[model samples]
Target: MSDDVRDSLIPYDEIVQDALRAVVGRVLSQIVGYDSLPGEHHFYITFKTQAVGVDIPAHLIAKFPDEMTIVLQNRFWDLKVEQDHFSVGLSFNQTPSILTIPYASITAFVDPSVDFGLQFQVSDDDDTQPEPHDEADNDRPEVISEDGSNVVTVDFGKKR
Candidate 1:
């Protein structure tokens, strides 16, 4: 293979990214449709709190600042998935609340029991750039092991 630069009219990377994100939406839709989860099937969805179409609470935005992880399991309601986003009702120490998250905002999605996961690339609109946002924050691994057990990390990075 030779290293060369070429331009195409279609943006293949963007299209594939969109499709992969849709998988997350479709999976969530199916789980919500079942009305309950089977065995240890659960999701830990991590997303950018400040991204477009994300509708988290002000307090949550302050707390998470950059990103946040949400678990969809025993305590949720009104699960709705849309083209570019999804919304769900959750509780903060018994305080009921609703949140809408765009697929573009998502950074990572994990199912520890099944060892399945997906990590999304940041959108162009994000002003964070390639520079580290925070030294301590960058030092921490992007995906943390769930339940203190080995978890698989899937890399989408590839050469086309």
Candidate 2:
């Protein structure tokens, strides 16, 4: 057998990414009605600051610039989960800020209590560019072909 792998025309990368992002949505949805995270289940969600549909405060954007990680352990409110994005109220420096982050913009999701994590790779062909970081600095990758504390990483870049 040859070592050559074919580039898929089915956009497997996009499909996988979308599906994995949905996992994040589903997990969040579960906590919506209760309005609280269950027993020892806090989250650390990281996302791109400048993605297409992200709505965060200006100061946060300035501070994060490329990426930001928010902890959902406690002291959060207005947890809203939608098909493509999620919004929550969090306090930074004692100042409350609401963040609306699209699933497309999310780079990582971690439930440290369970040692679970997901990382993604985001690309904005025209005016934006994907952040440069380690393969697993919370990149929200879709493909789950790695070993590290239940962390699922999605990377479909073709090898040429």
Candidate 3:
């Protein structure tokens, strides 16, 4: 085999990313259909706050300027799932707010009860650049385990 490499015309990386994001949509749809999370199952969805199509309160954007992780647990309501995005009502400091997040903006999803997780690459939106945030500074509950038991991470490198 030669060391030379060639780029394919198909955008396989983007296709696979879309497919994985659909998994998150399907799972959220099931929860919405049931009207609640099953048993102890819940989700920790981390997304880029500045991503396009993300509609969050100004306060939240101020607090989490780069990225934010929301826990879909006991207090969330109005769980609406769309083909490419989801909207849900949550409270921050006793103030209720509704957030709409596009699937493309999501960087991570996890269900700690089952130790399941999925990590995605940031979408290629030339208009917006994602800012990095330190995980140590985040206040959300830890969802990914260190044992690496059931977590699924998908990484498709840039197409050359």
Q: Relative to the unseen true structure, what is the Cα RMSD of model 2?
A: 5.2
Poorly placed runs, candidate 1 (over 4 Å): 1-4, 33-36, 124-160
lDDT by residue (46-134, candidate 2, tens digit) is: 88888899999998776667887777766788989999999999888888889999999987888877878888888756646545543
Which regions of candidate 2 are displaced past 4 Å?
1-5, 124-147
| Cα lDDT listed for each candidate | 0.72, 0.79, 0.83
Angstrom error of the Cα, residue 5, model 3: value is 5.1
TM-score, candidate 3, is 0.84
TM-score for each of the candidates: 0.75, 0.81, 0.84
Q: lDDT: which is higher, 2 or 3?
A: 3
Tell me the tens digit of each residue's lDDT in model 1 across 1-160.
Answer: 3355444467776787788888899988886654446788878888887788889888777767777778876667888888889999888757677999999888787776676777777664544544324322212244455653544333444446
Ranking by TM-score: 3, 2, 1
Count of clashes in candidate 3:
0
Task: Please provide, for model 3 over 95-139, each residue's C-alpha lDDT reduced to its tens digit, 9 standing for 90 to 100.
Answer: 888999999999999988888998898856573666655542335
What overall lDDT, based on C-alpha atoms, would model 1 receive against the true structure? 0.72
User: Which residue pairs show backbone clashes in model 1?
Assistant: none
Worst 10 residues of 1 by lDDT: 131-140
